[model samples]
Target chain A: TQLLEQSPQFLSIQEGENLTVYCNSSSVFSSLQWYRQEPGEGPVLLVTVVTGGEVKKLKRLTFQFGDARKDSSLHITAAQTGDTGLYLCAGARSGNTPLVFGKGTRLSVIA
Target chain B: EPEVTQTPSHQVTQMGQEVILRCVPISNHLYFYWYRQILGQKVEFLVSFYNNEISEKSEIFDDQFSVERPDGSNFTLKIRSTKLEDSAMYFCASRRGFGLVMNTEAFFGQGTRLTVV
Candidate 1:
């Protein structure tokens, strides 16, 4: 089975603090996606990284895929209370395959 | 914008009872999927449906779990015999097309919380 292991299962930081969460795997993926989920709700797609070593930014959130396509990282700059949620990383081996998800990192940003 | 929608935000049922979780995927989406997340657990894929047939399924999708796209727009997941371990948040997702170039982003529904007691 393909597994995506995430680090620091839980995190708590004050507002204006920066944080980085990581997702690593032994297998390579064709694409990787980042999602944020609120309690009792399904995950919301934040970004998708298809190329190795690719970096994408959305407002204060920055996402990067590793050069080997086996890992990825999410960095939050000056996080706010709204950033508090569960961040998940999902990877797809190919276009027609199902996505394998990481355990996720639960982030709590205090204001 | 179009999005996936699920019915019965929450449901509570007795053990061994049957329950059906319903979802309406985006009008233009061609691929559909079912996923479940146990409390404080990672989201796991149950099954994937395309062309009115199951394209892929995980080991977790046993005989007790089944998926159907009865109509053109609605996708349904039925749990024949629920157990205490069946309790989880079930999410339905869909994507527009397949392949590396086309949009592969899957849009997810709000999800249905199933509590089996």
Candidate 2:
């Protein structure tokens, strides 16, 4: 089975602090996605990275796909309380395959 | 925006009882899936459905678990015999394209919380 290992299982930082979470895998994936889930809710897709060495930014959030297609990262700049949630990284071997998800990083931004 | 929706936000059932979880996928989506997440664990894939049949399923989807798209828009997952281990949050997801493309992103529902007694 393909597994995605995420680092920094839990993080707590004051408002305006920056944080980065990493996701790594031994198997290559055709695509990878980042999601944020709040309590009592399903994961909401934040971004999808398809090409290696690709980088995308959404407001204060930045996502990067590794050059080898086996790793990815999410960086939040000047984080706010709203950024607090569970961040999950998921990979797909192909378009048809189901997603393999990492255990996720629980982030708390204290104001 | 259109989104996947699930019914019965929470459910509680006795062991060995049958339960059917319901989902309404986006009107234009062509692919559907079921996934489960145990408390504090990663989400695991259960099954994928397309073209009126099961396209793929994980080993966790045994004979006790079945999926059906009875009508044109509603997708359902039935657990024949629930056990204590069956307690978890079940999520339904959908995507708009065939599985051959590289960037098909799935939209997930709010999920149903199942508790077995």
> Comparing to the true complex, what docking class would candidate 1 get?
medium
Query: What is the DockQ for all candidates, taken in turn?
Result: 0.79, 0.70
For residues B26-52, write the lDDT of model 1, one tens digit per residue.
999889999999998899999999999
Model 1 Cα displacement at A68 (Å)? 0.8
lDDT of each residue in B13-58, candidate 2, tens digit only: 9999999999999998888999999998999999999999999999
Stretches of candidate 2 exceeding 4 Å from the true structure: B98-103
lDDT of 2: 0.94
Give lDDT tens digits, candidate 1, residues A3-49. 99998899999999999999999999999999999999999999999
Could you tell me which 10 consecutive residues in candidate 1 chain B have the lowest summed lDDT? B95-104
In angstroms, the error of model 1 at A67 is 0.7
User: What's the residue-level lDDT of A32 in candidate 1?
Assistant: 92
Q: After TM-score superposition, what is the CA distance of residue A11 in candidate 1 from its true location, in Å?
A: 1.0
